[model samples]
Target chain A: MIKRNIFRRTILISLFIILFSASTFIGILDIKLIDLLKLDREAWHNFLYFRIPRSVSIVLASAGLAVAGIIMQAISQNKFISPTTSGTISATQLGMLVALLLFPMGSSFVKFGFAFISALIFSIFLMVILNKIKIKNIIYLPLIGMMYGSIISSITSVLAGMFGKLQTVQSWNVGSFTLLVKGRYELLYIIFIPVLLAYIYATKFSIVGMGEDFSKNLGINYKSVILLGLVLVSIISSLTYIIVGPLPFLGLIIPNIITLIYGDNLKKSMIDIIFLSAIYILICDILARTIRYPYEIPISFVAGVFGSLIFIIILFGRVKYGSK
Target chain B: MAQNKKLQTGIISLAIIVIICYMLIKLIGVRSLFALKMIVKVRFPKLLALTVSGVLVTSASLVFQSIVNNRILTPSMLGFDAIYIAIQTIIIFLLGSVNFLLNPIYNFILSTGLMIIVTLIMYRLVLQKSKNNVVILLLIGLILTTFLNNMVTFLQSIMSPDEYLNLSAGISISLTNMNLDLVLIALPIMITCIVLFYCDAKRLEIISLGEDNAINLGLSYNKEVIKHLIYIAISMAIATALVGPLSFLGLIVVNLTREIFKTNNYKILIIFSGLLAIIFLLLGITILEIVGHITTLPVIINLIGGIYLFYIVIKENKI
Candidate 1:
């Protein structure tokens, strides 16, 4: 068992190294390893200023989203719930609209603040609603979240139309990594704090997954832990959205794939979730850039295509495995 | 007797609402004979498009919910709208900004034929292997919608700004900007499809009693399901092509019909559903007109319909 575990770890680490290097190197500008060795000034400038920041932002956004998904699934005790399907991302988009309207010259910090507050409120509202309903089929939960999301998004679009900012918001909503630059993408670093908090509270989240009664019986502060988990989720998700736009289905799909492979113990699976998320997103980002050659497709579109395909496979696998 | 009285009151109210809507559209601000004539020409086609689209969506939703045995499901869940958007994007992408390709006649034929073929393929893949597990079907439908939406977005990204603007303008379902000639063509196709659906009302009633019961009663359940799905695909395609996609109008209209009429008869359901849909559209359009058409009708419908669906799902689950 130890030997097999070590082998798996080595494979994962090597895969991560390979994908990280490939994604960092493969962009419009050709920066070969030989150029790096010879210290070519132009290649070094592009690598330092553009490629590294782009890769860092991609890793941070995917890891943040995946971690947020894990925290959300743990708290809600539903495997399918995520920021994309739930009203969280749309609420943040709405908040961004409000920010753009109210403070046209505001910094990213002000926008992030508005988005975080709205995301928190909307996600908590959804949690309360989910708690009240006794859903027999778990699938309805995500469907309801999706419908709620559409309503929120429509409201945002209507407001954008009223202000003639529809095109701006539409472009912002489409996730892309090509917009990242050295100074522009530093806001994504804010996610690291919430991700750290998530790791600290991972065990309590697992207990919360067992229900309030179970947590209380174990003498844990159920409300605070759940609140903290939600706060962390909202912060991570909103920050990612503000920096990288919405990464559709990444949250739901990554955590689901992680739990399927590594089991559901949050403490043990946290590292695996983070690493796997980075690798998955790096591969998707690489595909997005290379699929149309010079003109890049949006990262969300590529992620949506791949994530939803895997989601369907997971659903079928559950039906076959769980029923038998 | 109570059900009959309820149906009578519903129909009466629906008629009154339609009449009021017609007056608001035709004579709200008419000043002269020339203006009246102009108003009638524009308003009549707009009203016809509204009525046709509402009927198509509502009837399709009712038939879909009945067949799926789940009131929460709408035909839009089957990704018909995404398919419509994708076809439009491809047309504009390949042919550029040509008016000939964008004409309602060509758009209708292309969208309906493609939607029917795609949905038939999806039905075969989903229903071929197992008993119709609705949850699985719904998941597949949802994922397929996301997949197709992504495809559209990818295409839109590559498109020039002018072409993209044109595509976005026609993307939403709006009665204000509908093609009058296309409405004339779509009205006949929509009516024919609904008539076929109405003809299968008895079979639909049987299929609603669960698949096993329908099969035990000597009905070829799969064959009937396939036939109704084709009918639904064609009507939905026509409606969507004419007015873009109204994702939740059908859900709101059909659920209101079931609540008000409280009937199992598809014939009564179909008629009242059509009436109620027209009333809903007229009322929505009237409100939009009052508000100076700031937002389109589907956005309003989806906002309210989605909230109502959320409420209904929570309430039903509470019981």
Candidate 2:
């Protein structure tokens, strides 16, 4: 078992490296390692300014959300709940709009604070609603979440439209790394803290997953852990959303795929989740750039196409009924 | 015999008339015969479009909800709106704005056709596999919608700013500045659908009662599911294709109709849904126009309707 795990990790990490380099180098501007070695200004500028930040953002955002998904599933006790399906991204978008409207020209921290707060509030709201509903079918969880997200997005659109910032909000909502520059994409790193927090509280989250009564009997603070798990989810959700907009289904798909292989051992499978998410999003980002050549489609589009297709297949394979 | 029902009906009609009059009052300047002809040719079609499409969509949604035996689920979950917007995107992407703009007839055919086809494909995929699990079906449709929505936005991003702007304007449900030709073309089909739906009102009400009720009443519930779903899909596609996508309006209207009319009779409920739809949409459009039409009609309606959906869900016994 140990050897098999090692072998799997080796293959996944190797795959990640290859895809990472490929995503980093393949773009509109042609640059080679030789130019960076020779202190080439233009090559270095493009690499540092656009290509590297974008590629890094891709990796960071994917890794962050993938772990966030695991955290969400554990705390919510439903495999279907993720940032993509839940209202977190939509709430983040709305909060960003609020920040934009309020500050107009505020610092990124203010926007980040706003995004995090709204996502946290949204998490609390959804949990309250979820607690009230006795769901037999797991699909109902994501169903309610998706409707909530759409409603939140509708509110966001109305506000953005009222402010005459509809186009800008629309652009932000479309998850893409094309506009990533040095300063713009750096805020994505903050999501990494939530990821670390996920790792620390992994066991508690899985225990929380069992249900409120079980967790409390096990001498855990049921509510606080749930709050903590959701907070971690909200943080990663809002930060990555503010940075890369939204990577559609990245969170949901990665954890699901990871679970199939590694089971629900969050502590053990965290690295694997990161590896898979990084590689998956790297492939998406590369395709988004290369598919239309000079004019890049958003990574969310590529991810959505691939993710939903994969999700349907996975859904059909496992979910025969709502009986479970 | 209830005064409340009478009062509600009177109130809705009054709101509809007041809003319509307010909208038309602005167009009061038409002294010349040529100007009168212009009003008849141009403004008349838009007024007709809003009223007809509103009624069309609300009825379609009512039938859909009744078929599924769920109050909160709108026909939008059938992936109608997303497919409509997606087809519009593909048209703009392929042949530029001219195909969608100068030739409204082609988009009308292509858009509605694609919408129906997508719905059929979804039906085949989910219904056949799951033996008609509505929740699973809703989930699949929701997934498809988000995917298509993402695809449309991505395409719009690739488009030039001007073209993208035009596409956004065209896709968003707008009350003002509609195509007269498309509205005229859609009017006959929408009316036909509404009439056809009304004919099946009694059967639908039986279905809405519950599966056992439907079965006891000699309705082969499972077999009839596909037929009604197809009808719902086609008419919804037609309605959404006509007036962009008023996704939440249907949910809001149908529920309100049931609440106000307090009738299990699909006939009365369907007619009330139509009138309430016109009242809500006309007032919504009036609000949009009053507020400088800064945003689209669907956005505001969706905002209100979404909240109302949560209200229904929360107020219901945990289903």
Q: Which candidate gets the maximum TM-score versus the true structure? A: 1
TM-score of chain B of each: 0.91, 0.92
lDDT of 2 by residue, A4-123 (tens): 999999999999999988887998789999999999999999899888898898888899989888888888888888987888988998899999999999987899899999999987
Which residue pairs show backbone clashes in model 1? none
Tens-digit per-residue lDDT, B120-207, candidate 2: 9989889888778776788888888989888887777778887887788778874455777778788888788878888988788888
| Docking model 2 quality class | medium
| Model 2 residue B177 lDDT score | 52
lDDT of 2 at B278: 78
Query: Looking at candidate 2, what is the lDDT of residue A124?
Result: 91
Full-model lDDT, candidate 1: 0.83
